[model samples]
Target: MSTSDPYVDLRSRAFAIAYQMLGSVGEAEDVMQEAFLRLHRTQRDGETIASPRAYIATLVTRLAIDQWRSARARREQYVGEWLPEPLAADPSPGEHAETADSLSLAVLVLLETLTPQQRAAFLLREVFDYPYTEVAEIIGTDVDTTRHLVARARRRVRERRPRYHATRQQQRRLAGRFFAAVEHGDLPALEELLAQDVAMHGDGGGRVPALGRPLNGRQPVARVLAAMAPLLARAGGVRFDLTKVNGQPGALVFDTRGLLVAVMALDITDGHIQTIHSIVNPDKLQHFGRVGNLGDLVRADPDPTGDA
Candidate 1:
């Protein structure tokens, strides 16, 4: 929107590229700014960019891959389960509706299983529809290698991804029921709503009270939820807002004080909750405004009332 900025026109695409690669809003915005700086310097130095879009795209892709690789080590050593930062909704880019399939929390988590080159290759070719030749050029690999990277990454994602992603309406009904059972401490009803092998993943990021490991099976998960129901009744009880999270049907958790306390995303299959991702990291809630610290809630309640 700034005519004074030379890279203004390419900003959206640059953001899209960086976001898809880094899977973090803060880092994506930062990488895009770096891309713009480089673009400005190049043009200011009397260099004519024959294809500014490609040039910027390539720049952002490379930068994001570098950051992602470096961050991978830190991520692996992170205290608890790591979930991608949740975005409330897709941001608009003028009139064109930007596709957000790859930007979802689910897909981004799957992308983490990939190597940086594989992620870059797959996103460029599969998600962005870039040509193999161009993807290779951008990734600094051969065309065949780029094609192989995309193929390998795609296969792993397909195999690990949920069999079905329920409709938003279905998700709303399901989430409503899931938490209702929790509020009522009805373990049987809640367990029935989940798949037999359902697994719940909580990401407290070692900064909050969360399940230290993935809880597997319906019975165990249900029992834990039932036990925590009372604690969730703090203040005015936990309120659930059926909202879009990273382009998927998810819910935001707010305490009685109207502060966002958690981000909950469910992967549904066959009308059943397959996986529940509970993100309670305060660091991941900056977008939700000033949220109360998890420590405060733990100290105050210290009771059983948790949600994912």
Candidate 2:
């Protein structure tokens, strides 16, 4: 509300841009504040900038890109698995409401595989609807180059996407069945629900002895479930509460103390789970604050006795 700055409009735009790029509220705030500080410092020094809004956006994008690179290295060294922290509410709906219709946790996780430039381009163009010329300016690349980047990025993402769509109610019902299988160690039921070519990718960051690579095929996925049985057994019990991630149905796992320990997201196609993504790395979990009262998802407590 301060009128001291002539570029007030630019500040608001910068914040929206940062939030969309980082997808973390805390991180977005940091980027926005830093960009503004830089702007103030430049003005104080009597430096002139053309299009302050664009300049601020460029700075924020650069910062986000750098963070993405550093995060990639850390994720590479992470423990058991890497899952994008489930948002208490969908971050995508605000800025990315349109493309968000098809958003999935599995897809966001796949985004981690893209380079920072590609990620920025895809988000700017697909999510923000930025034109190619503007996208090029923000990314510091030519328009042709930007176009190619977006195309390639989209193609790669499409290749990894599974074919599936289910109503929220149906999803909830299937999720219940999924947890039941895991709780009882019912491999047959698990296999039945999983696609024949099921793929499970755990981002353990090489910290925990996890399935470092994508586990493909029904047999391999089944083996993964088998391997985790002992761990789940040792934990005594687990509870799957529904939550939102990138605006899609996600599962939040908590321990007896109600402290969140892990989150799982699935990609279902034709009533079958094609992909199961589990995020257990504590560092990643930090971004996702406590799963606020999920109401009925918690009330049902399919395995409340901790013996499911």
Candidate 3:
């Protein structure tokens, strides 16, 4: 790679690496900005860096690790479950240079369980294709140790990662079915699509009332969905626009006014809905564009007379 293109061509690549490491668009962007400042300072100070791309990657990686540590603390005290801010990802086919191969909403949630160093090591080596030697230097460890960290991280993640038994189209079909079931309050239908031990998570961040703990099991999860479904029409009208939430089949919910409301992503395992990741946190949603008040799901009835 040419030195000059590092500033322009590698911009998106930098964001991809940071996003994979930090899992927050806002924070990743911030890391990139800080990295730009550092690069400028180095250049202005008459420093001669051999490779701008590697230098920027190193800067972003270290910064991201710091951000992850800081954010992890706040997340521990977050009002409710904390989910990575969702993004509408562009279509990526084949082994694209920017492919965060296993990066998804659910996978990121799993990544959260890995120690920051382990996560950093795994991402640097596995996702970004950084050589083990470079990965070690980036995370400040020996090459052999970095290899072990990546191996251990991979093992831990594999133990928790979903088998991905369903194709994108199949997953989308299931998502559509589940959304429809919720919209119409079809409890039986909801149950049919959910895995026996399906899990549901909601992130309202206390700005809105949301379940703090995950709801597990098909029956309980289904019941909650049936109850929450009314929140849709209660908004008078809402749009469930199909979107790829973190590279998975998901939707961008909008109220009647065309404002983004909730961003939902699903994990489908064995052809059944296994997990639902819902982000209603206004703070998080603010970066998600626009959304309506989820608290209003109770007041407005989708159909008061029970005619529909």
How do the predictions measure up, each by TM-score? 0.87, 0.73, 0.89
Residue 37 of model 2 has an lDDT of 90
lDDT of 2 by residue, 97-150 (tens): 445533456666677778889988987788668789989999999999999999
Better of 1 and 3 by lDDT: 3
Candidate 3 backbone overlaps, count? 2
lDDT of 3 by residue, 1-308 (tens): 55565467567767877887777889999999899899999999999989888898889989998998998888889886777887876435644533533667778888888988898898878777899999898889999999999999999988887766787789789889988787788999999999999988888777767777788999988887787666665557566787778777788877777777688888888989888988876677777666677656555543222322
The local distance difference test score of model 3 is 0.79
Show pairs that collide, candidate 2: 78-205, 79-207, 79-208, 80-204, 81-203, 81-204, 82-203
Model 1 reaches what TM-score against the true structure? 0.87
Whole-model lDDT per candidate = 0.79, 0.68, 0.79
Residue 82, model 1: Cα distance from true site in angstroms: 1.3
When 2 and 3 are scored with TM-score, the better candidate is 3
Please rank every candidate by lDDT, starting with the best: 3, 1, 2
**Model 3, residue pairs in steric clash:** 260-290, 260-291
lDDT of 1 by residue, 264-294 (tens): 8777788898888888888888867977655
List of clashing residue pairs for candidate 1:
228-304, 228-305, 231-304, 232-305
